[model samples]
Target: MPKRILEMTAIEVARLREDGDHSVGGVSGLYLQIIGASRCWMLRYTHLGKRKRMGLGIYPTISLAVARDSARAAAALVQTGIDPKRAREDEREAARMHDAKQLTFKQAGEAFIKEHEPGWKNLKHIDQWKNTLATYAYPKIGKLLLSQIDQAYVLQVISPIWSTKTETASRMRGRIEQILDWATVHGHRSGVNPARWRGQLEYLLPNPDKVAPIEHHEAVPYEDLPQVYKQLCAIKGQAARALRFVIFTAGRSGEVRGMKWQEVDLFRAVWTIPGERMKSGREHRVVLPPQAVEFLRNQPRRKDREDLVFPSPRGTFLSDSTLSKLMRDHKINGVPHGFRSTFRDWAGETTHHPRDAIELCIAHVIDNKTEAAYRRGDMIKKRVAIMKDWADYATSETTNPA
Candidate 1:
């Protein structure tokens, strides 16, 4: 037996009260249930000789008319052997998938770095990527969804700094472009990257060099080397010796900082810097003059497995800035790397050594790849003479025991 049907009205629906369901007859089997303070609608019916209930919504939110309409629809689905509960769950899952596809720019940037950071050559590059995003791009559009980013948003990140801090802005633009491309490839985003330069951003921003010119490192004048050499030899301690060796060897500060005792062969009189440590990614053989070899043999020995030729006080490879500070403290205007320039000038002007031999001494990649490929020998005989002469001239002004 069942109650006869009339359209359920708002007043009759509000009067619903009981410990269980109160039938509000309109669409068949529709019930208004009260449990404590909560009131909701449900459709009750039998299907396949089994009774089931499906929630329509809460009271006040789903009015009597709306509840009846929804219950009738659920009843229709049940009549056709469809489960409303499972259908609702499927609908919720689809909504979640849509939200996930709208990944924010910051989220995409972090994912990009995670995928690529392991392959990057230096830890500093990771720091650079994170720092640039935090300072520029993150504030501008990081919260926006990946698909929301456009050329206008990219301009917002880069335009202000493009002219004033050109180098930093250029790096940030490249980083943003890379992150967008990564997102697009992964299907989190689509279409051309707004940060791209070749066809898109290039038309928007001015050339970087036009805004800020590349500046060469300042060098010590070749004629002033005698006095500078004298002053350098007078300083005491391991850092001073390291600085002198950096100049004498014409090595990059990074190479000198990480120099190992094993890399030097005193008997052979050459320092073999491996490809991994060199910027050129090729093993370079620097022929040590007699003075250079004598200086190295006299250095304090260590018992550690990887004994550093010039270790810091903490027994680690010395900090690259250690030599820079040494020069500043001594009131020399030239940087440690500027010594290579001084060596080049001296080689070009004073020595009769072949240009390629001089280039090899300083580890420059010779322009003629064919010649470089064919030449197996490092011209040890000629290089030996040139190195000896350069060493002699450098030390000619300073004979004081250091």
Candidate 2:
């Protein structure tokens, strides 16, 4: 028979200051473990002929009354053939998993961005995601748990901006949908995404297209392009040269502004834009005409492959605004992007160039998948002839309409 241990009162337990384990009565195997200044509650028990110690909690905070109850519960588990220490560990693990799945909306968005940022080619795109969420979504549902978010919360973020900044609001809604989908896939959230546009959100929000009609960039007419080209040649500086280069190549302002010396080949009359730099995510080979080649030959050469072809006065990438301002200062009608439209009109209306060749020169993606698959080569020979003819026509002295 086991000897009966005396149970100690709260007052008696409080008086224990010796630096050793003192058995606190009312529960078997319960002790006040005192080591110098440290005091805590520890339970000692035997499982399968081996003794084990388990920490209930720290002293004072987990009082004598609470410790006794916890010890009894642990003892009950041990009596039922379970290791109380193992059972407690399992409970802690389950709690950790539950907490992990309760991530806030902002937390889930940040995690999703971090996970996918490696695959994103542009840092600006990553910044855009962060900025949009911070500006709109974060203020509304950032702190709310992913499981708690619904259509109402999503509308709270985007509704005000929907009618005013329709495009931005539409993009924000799409991003929210993606983040919610990512959370569901990762087990941080469950249920249908409230931000989805196709079936759910479509019924709720008014059509974005109807709210704000799409606006194309204003372009110069092809008939006036020759006169415009002549006037552009009169303007001096890198921005003017870059604008001319854009027109010559029929390239986007962003593409031309970010061009590096390595991309140019004066010897071969080719400017190869790598897939990463191109909007289509595919390499584009531009066949430079004599005028375009001459323009490149005259620019200051650099030893560094990464040096910008048209750098700013500070020796950095030229801003799109600089080119736009140049056009404005000289009273040139239409924006810099308008030149692409100008080039397209000239090629389509005036020239006898094949439709495919003209489209390829402007780096336009073919709408027909079968046609694109069959047209494997870039048709560089056709493009070279077309560009030369366009350049000659642009540089030619034409009488302005009287």
Residues 86-131, model 2: lDDT tens digits: 9889989999999978999999899999999976777789899999
lDDT of 2 at 377: 95
How far is 228's C-alpha from truth in model 2 (Å)?
1.5
Q: Candidate 1 lDDT, tens digit per residue, 296-387? A: 87889787756888888878877767788888998998888898898899999987889999998899988999998999888878888888
RMSD of each: 6.0, 4.8
Backbone collision tally, model 2: 0
Off by over 4 Å in 2: 1-92, 118-124, 302-306, 370-375, 398-402
lDDT of 2: 0.89
- Scanning candidate 1 in windows of ten residues, the lowest lDDT window is 1-10
Which candidate ranks first by lDDT, i.e. highest? 2
lDDT for 17 (candidate 2): 83
